[model samples]
Target: MTEKIAIQTKNISKRYVIGTKNSKPNTLAGEIINFISTPIRNFKKLRSLSNNTTDNTKTIWALQDIDLTINEKEIVGIIGSNGSGKSTLLKILSKITIPTTGEALINGKVGSLLEVGTGFHDELTGRENIFLNGTILGMNKKEVEENLDKIISFSGVSNFIDTPVKRYSNGMRVRLAFAVAAYLEPEILIIDEVLAVGDSSFQKQCLGKMDDVAKSGRTVLFVSHNMESIMTLCTRVIWIDEGKIIKDGDPVSVVNEYLETTNTISETNINLENINKRGGDGSIKFTNLTIMDKNQKEKTQFNIGDTLNLSISLKAIEKGLLNSNLTIKILIKNQNNTTVLSFNNESYNHFIKLDDKNNKIQFSIPKLPLGQGLYSISLEVWVNGGKADTVGDVGVFESTPGDFIGNGIPDQEHSLFHTNSVWS
Candidate 1:
């Protein structure tokens, strides 16, 4: 028998009207008056237009002409930058909002966690909301009873189960909300970036729950900014930009293309006119900073195991040089602003040296642990045990997928550190 398609969309689109107030009249008389004064309004708008015009009354297409299909038991990842419509797509799939046009077909029940505390009532106690959300998802009372204890225990909020949700801390709220959604046993699961709110341990638990759900042959639609999570969990990936699908294929390839196209570095003359210093006792300032590849050319091409060398030039501004130390930090992030690897100044403090002349601070990562995808870097300079200057608006590079002839695992041998792997 042929496998069934779990979800499918034809020309799905969502448009949001921004900067226009609801008080704008919608009657026929109002329309005629606005139409007659269109020319004068146009002239006034042109005169008052500025850089912030994009923020004024304008229409933004969150999702446009998006066509997709997912097979049963498939785990698909949606990757994009902020406002790229990843969450908006999930919201539509969950029936939280209707599409502006087109049709969506879902083959099974869908459980969604779009935002923190979504599908929850602050006035209701944690226990009450569990039943309420489950019922909303079509579960009867007996079914919810069978899973009540398991959900409460999994959330690690047994002590606060009877307390009102509004009184819970932010972390507690996320734990409860995630527990409820994950336990619903829906045939299709849709998750947003809510996993980012919990602590590291809690995040690990959530990843395990998702893995179990996938193992049960259920379809999962996950949206996140963490490339590591996407590579580790997804069977396939889709990249979206400016409300359009740019690439859809294997996770590594799609992520690599998105990173390469977004981050571009050139050899233009260094401009320090608008440099901002980070908070700390000012002992040193970064005079110059540039990223270069192994060939000494300013480029952003890299691979999974490639070596990246960052060259930074700095100078001592104060003469009273005590036991001052120089440090370098490197952060690897995806297009969604999720951080994968963060190396700070303290990690390289042992290699500091005193220099009266222009000093070059060099830090190199022998082999990038990330898989094939796009990653950006954030650099920081420290002096006298405090941050001096930080620069990180446009530092990015691409990691091409390596040759791994084995199973689907990429060059990175380790899974997302969030999983618990043990032999039974």
Candidate 2:
């Protein structure tokens, strides 16, 4: 049995020119002279675009030697850090931009929701734009009308379907755009990170719809930073870093590798303000984190049965938030990126009071139950049922198996977590 190929890219690469700035002259007379010669300099720079003598230092290769073959019915997820060329590759596939030195052959019609309001006319009503998109996808009027009701109902924008698209809010526009891209039935659907603009409930609905599309034997290309969504929805995953394919394989393995590589914090005492790999709306910020023992001494190494304590400091961005309640959570994951233990205040109906009297949280584990291994810590804070801040890999600690089961001899590789039991 042979599977049909839906998209293929051969040596696909994209390049962009980096702008350079001229040094400002200190003297007024020097500035005047430099300003007088600006036109000639601009002319030479403009002319250099068509010449072969371009400075390699002033240009960046957004993609390099990207060879990929995506088959029909496979939902592939592309993940990477910011400026890692994830969006550029999607743009190339959507025909929004062309590669510098390669070709991408697509077998079927592609419906792309790369950005909010993409492929939609601002002046056109939502109803009219639905037909416009269908027409662009080579569908006739009857074909579009057949699915028009489904699209409108699924978008939850039936009330505003007759309104101009420009008048719609960002969330409304995303809902309608996603509904159109999904219900219109393009053979290949490409979605970027625009779903972050919608509400949580809407995002879940979109994920469900994407799953349905995958079951219908259509190809889906999804780009998102949400690792859980990628793991659940994607059949395969592709990790991109610095414009090149880092890993492509099973979703769990690839995502684990990506998270391990991107998590750079490894010390016991960590400053959280500088890390860029965090999420949430930033209404609450994690300022500092420390791993300590019962004596309040900081350390990164602990025995399997030792008492461990985590101290965290948070700051509210707005003064009004100081009076609100906050739900704090911490997750502990092994080196393989599997969460072995998680602590959430809300699970027990306990929440931290955000007031001037208290802004610090301390979580203590009396007897660590984990076997000998390395583990990472992830932090999350929520307010008003929304995520205020989330940071992964905030710190890491090493554990050594030390009589956790009350035996003289400890087995290090017996299991990931230690447990107490009695044989019948």
Candidate 3:
């Protein structure tokens, strides 16, 4: 069977000039004139991007020669570091921004949620905005009316359906915006990291909705930092770096590569003092992390069944915190960003007292059950029932094949971790 292309981009590139200024209109009439001529000015600038090459320092390319073809019903996940142009490509596909050179060709109507409150009017009620967005998608009032209730219910914002969008919080706006976009039944759906604004439950709901949309013979383009969600929902993955395609293929292979190359800490020992804190108050802070083997020799690689050791140093910043009931936790996740193992002092009813000068903790796994793959570690500290300090991806370790069972058959094919089993 032949595949139908839903979206295509040929040599698509976008350039932004730094320090460029636009004059604001002073009067209502001037504002109206500016709005009408803005498209012409943008077109001229886009055209000039091809011929003007005088000052390269002033311009930055967000995308370069991005050629892609997405077939119908294909859910593609786009992953990259910040400023890698994932959002720029989405904006171009949504018509929110114009590319400096080349063009993006898209078939069928597109519904996009690039950012919070996008395509929504501040003064318009959530109900009104639904119809407005549907209209923008070329749907009539009756069609929007048919799905209005479902959208509101799914968004869980039925209570504020009649409230002006400006009065809604960021989460509320995201909920409503996603409902309208998903329920509108566009042929292609484009979603950015805006879903991160919603809570975990809502994010799950949105992912499920995207899955349903794909099952119905539509196309989905998702951009997110959540590797698990990307692997679960997307059949294909694309990695972008420095405004170019670095990798694109199977979800597992692409995601594993991206995580290993981008998130892995090559050093066996990492200084946590300078690492940015992800959450919790500033009462306590992790100072350092060291990964080692059974011999206490620092190493980043270990064989399966080999002992894994970790030493974490922490210090209290506030007075009396050392005496407080503190709980320490270590979380390990696979290359897919899914938590594989977790250890906490509180879980085992292990009470630990901290000293003012000696505030180091050690954790050891007698037999590393992990297969041949990279794993990340996260550290957390809680004081007196409140979170004191927390950080993610503090360190990474690689596990290689080893003799777990008597007959050493490599067993990382279907599972992340290996376990011994006996056959009767």
Q: Write the per-residue lDDT of candidate 1 for residues 50-90, one digit (tens) a residue.
A: 22343423556788999999899999999876667888898
User: Between candidates 2 and 3, which one is better according to lDDT?
Assistant: 2
Candidate 3 versus the native: TM-score?
A: 0.57
For candidate 3, lDDT tens digit of each residue in 209-245?
A: 8778778887889998888888888989999986899
Regions of candidate 1 where Cα sits further than 4 Å from its true position: 20-57, 264-336, 339-424
Off by over 4 Å in 3: 20-53, 136-138, 166-169, 266-424
**Predictions in order: lDDT:** 0.72, 0.83, 0.82
Clash count of each predicted structure: 0, 0, 0
**Each model's TM-score?**
0.58, 0.62, 0.57
Residue-level lDDT of model 2, residues 134-213, one tens digit each, is 67655689988999999899989999999999999988888887777666578998889866668889988988877788
Best by TM-score: 2
Q: How many Å off is the CA of 261 in candidate 1?
A: 2.8
**Model 2, stretches more than 4 Å misplaced?**
43-53, 119-123, 133-140, 264-424
So what's the TM-score on candidate 2?
0.62
